[model samples]
Target: MAKDKLRKVGEVAPEFHLYEADGAKVSLSDLLGENRYVLLYFTSTEEKSRCDRSGCPLKENLEKLIELDVTPVLIDVDPVEEHKRFKHDHNIKFLMLSDPAMETIKGYGVYEKVNIHGIEKEKIVSTAFLINPEGRIVHVWEPKKIEDSIDDIINAVKKLKGM
Candidate 1:
């Protein structure tokens, strides 16, 4: 299958509304409406290999992100209950969104159909995007290694904010 084209920097991010782990709805526009920069991550907790090292980069840079006043949001194609459990297990303090239907995931061009554990399923690719307060995508990281993406992400945010 052909991969969906990713939204590039300077383009308006595709708007989406998904539920957080607590079942609270969150919208991109609402987040931008408050002038908050968003570091959006498309991820999944099912793959042990990817999941094992997935959140470390974000977790390592959480304090720096907070210092920059950026809101980190993790979007996964998993159930709300699962997301809640994952967040708890990982000590994730930021918002963890549930995209069970993969609507928001595909909308962002991060959904990939792959074979996992010998079963075919649509899973989210490991990708991150930084949206500025004006709702434009300021940075994008299509990391080859999920665990090694933090430095690039942090540097992009710093460059975008002129810090």
Candidate 2:
């Protein structure tokens, strides 16, 4: 992944209109609710185990995020059906959005060319971002692995709410 291409803190998040795993339409504007923040997690389908382990913390602490007025969302290039299956399989309580076109994935600079079993392909490199209601990226929880990022996200949220 090109560091220069990645969206940074304070930058306005790129907008997109995507569908949830259940096929419901959604948009960045819709999630940026009044006085709230948006927590976005871009997942990798090829690394489902990683996805599950990374997502559990979010699922576990979902109520805390809600109480803090932060809406957590997951984005992946998987199809609506795949997303539906993954969501169901993982018991994800947050909105899992589909992005088969990779529009938003590339827009957010998370899309990368990766090698899988000797085949090179494009996909999102599991990422998380915390965005303020104003549409700006307040923080990127990618300084470490997915596990640490999730913790950082929650701690960052709590810290932001206190500010």
Candidate 3:
């Protein structure tokens, strides 16, 4: 999908039912509740390691995020088993969802087909979305906007919730 077609701030975030690292099915609504928020970060194969900048930023601030009632979810095209190994390797306790079928990735307009080593593969366009309890996209961090997204997300949630 094209970048322009992505779900933007103020729109209702797309619904998804994906498997977590433990192979448990989880839906978008399952994570929503009174005073709860979701910070979704899409993963890319470009990151050399699970503990790279892409994953650690949020992991580092996980406690503060939970204190604010926000759930940090990292979605990737990898399989559930891969997500499981990632959690084990990196000590990730947050939700790491698998989207091997690319359902959620395409729905969010973050899927792009790229050839690596002359073999075509589905890749994710790095993106982040902060969804409010009502499932509305309140904040978005596209590739270029994510220099310090963990901080930006926290501040956005704080500003929105009057914290």
Candidate 4:
């Protein structure tokens, strides 16, 4: 499989407006206006095994992220209701935005065409981006392992704060 081109550090992050689980609209510019940094996590809730392995740890560490003044946002290709239920089931505290059209996913350059269970589908590759208040991407992590991504994100947040 070919790797998708991703936004790199120092590039101005793409702006997007997506709906949260509660149907409230969230704009990237709005987040940047309020927070010093935004941690955008692109993931899926459809695959339970993968979601549990990757999403759970991030859910558990919400407080740490908050303390660092980084707003963590979860983006999924699922519908709003599905995202709502997923958050409820997992007790996730952060905002989980739904991008059913996958426009934001594609705009972020995380969308990939992959074969799953003998079926070809376009899915958002699990990725994390740290965008500074100036709307510049400060860190990008395309993890080979979900477990490692959590630590990478935390370290990236710390490093960004230190800078």
Among all candidates shown, the one with the greatest TM-score: 3
True-vs-predicted CA distance for residue 92, candidate 3, Å: 0.6
Ranking of candidates on lDDT, top first: 3, 2, 4, 1
lDDT of 1 by residue, 70-158 (tens): 88888887788887887788777888888888887777788667887999987677788999998989888776555567777777777
RMSD of each: 2.8, 2.3, 2.4, 2.6
Error of 2 at 75 (Å): 0.7
Regions of candidate 4 where Cα sits further than 4 Å from its true position: 1-4, 46-55, 115-120
For candidate 1, what is the TM-score?
A: 0.84
Q: Which residue pairs overlap in candidate 2's backbone?
A: none
Which candidate number has the best lDDT?
3
- Angstrom error at residue 9, model 2: 0.8
| Candidate 2 residue runs with Cα over 4 Å from true position | 50-55, 115-119, 143-145
Regions of candidate 1 where Cα sits further than 4 Å from its true position: 33-35, 47-55, 115-120
**Residue 118 displacement (Å), model 4:** 7.8
Question: What is the per-residue lDDT of model 4 for residues 125-158, given as tens digits with 9 covering 90 to 100?
Answer: 7788889889999888876544568777788778
lDDT on C-alpha atoms for all candidate structures: 0.77, 0.81, 0.83, 0.79
Instruction: Please provide TM-scores, in order, for all candidate models, with all chains considered together.
Output: 0.84, 0.87, 0.89, 0.86
Better of 2 and 4 by lDDT: 2
Rank by TM-score, highest first: 3, 2, 4, 1
TM-score of 4: 0.86
Overlapping backbone residue pairs in candidate 4 total 0
